[model samples]
Target: MDGFSFFIYAFLSIFVIVSPLSGVVTFISLTSNMTLHEKNEIAKKAVILACIIAVFFAVLGNKLLGVFGINVDSLRIAGGILLFTIAFDMMHAKISAESITEEEINRSQEREDIWIFPIALPLLTGPGTISAVIVLMGTAPGFQEKIMILAAIVLTFAISLLMFLFSRRIHRFIGYNGMLVFTRLMGLFLAALAVDLVATGIKNIFPMLGKLV
Candidate 1:
């Protein structure tokens, strides 16, 4: 693909997988007792932390994969399956257990470090996001393409930050059902992306399969 097209793909893939809207409900619930200022502070910290985590993995994930002797293609398939499961849960309008559990959410409400734990680590920059970053980096043919992927990551989290900052207002406007509709639509897109990843991984791993097609 050309550079612009690739960048768009990277941005959309990262954005859909991150699914900021899906987390708005959780964010609102967690910060229900806080003032608007406190909520905005948490949102800033969470998105900044999440963005750092994603960039860190995007830059070094492949080396870590090498340390474990794991192939990029293998991770592609694994990550694709993992993302698909999350997407499936999302399509049902359920909070993805892969990211966080009901118990965790309930427990997080009392924790002061909720921004770092559930919000940053798992919710925003979870395993699937990390895997996708690494895979995108691995698949990039050049440094420029890799940079584009990194830009996409930053843009995705920037949008997430805005979403979190206005999460309460957004929830008030969209309502729970409207949020569900958006989540399901994102889920559909993520499912398609996951299938593409799996197919690409298979094709790369077994070039003979490509010839057969």
Candidate 2:
């Protein structure tokens, strides 16, 4: 794809995987007992932390793969499978266990560093998000494409931070069922993207398969 098209794809892929609406839902639930100021603080901190984590992985993840002697295609296949499972859970309108469990969420309520723990680590930038960014970076052709991916990451989290800041208003506006509908639609798109990743990884690993196609 051309630069513009690739940038759009990168943006959508990162945004869909991040699913700011889903994060908004979790953020609302977590901060329901807090004051507006407190909630806003947590929201800002969480988004900044999540964005940093994603950018870190985007830049250095390939080096980590090299350390482990792992191929990018292998990671693509694995990340795709992981994302597909999360997508299935999202389609059902359930919070994916891959991100956070009910027990973790409950425990997070009593924790002092909830923003860093559940909010930033797993809830916002969980395994699925980490894997997706790394794989995206791996697929990028050069420095320019990688920069586009990084821009996508930054944009995704910027929007997410806004959603989190207005989370309460958004929750009340969207309602539970509306949020579910949106989650399902995003899930569908994510599943398709996951499949595409797996297929492309497979083709790359076996060039003869591409010839067959």
Best by TM-score: 1
**TM-score for predicted model 2 compared with the true structure:** 0.98
Residue 42 displacement in candidate 1 (angstroms):
0.7
User: What are the per-residue Cα lDDT tens digits for candidate 2 across 73-145?
Assistant: 9999999999999999999999999988888888888877888989999888988889889998987888899
Which whole-number lDDT from 0 to 100 does residue 182 have in model 2? 96
Best by lDDT: 1
Worst 10 residues of 1 by lDDT: 93-102
Query: What is the C-alpha lDDT profile of model 1 across 1-213, one tens digit per residue?
Result: 999999999999999999999999999888999999999999999999999999999999999999999999999999999999999999999999888999999999999999999999899999999999999999899999999999999999999999999898899999999999999999999999999999999999999998997
lDDT of 2: 0.92
Task: Give per-model TM-scores.
Answer: 0.98, 0.98
What TM-score, to 2 decimals, does candidate 1 have?
0.98
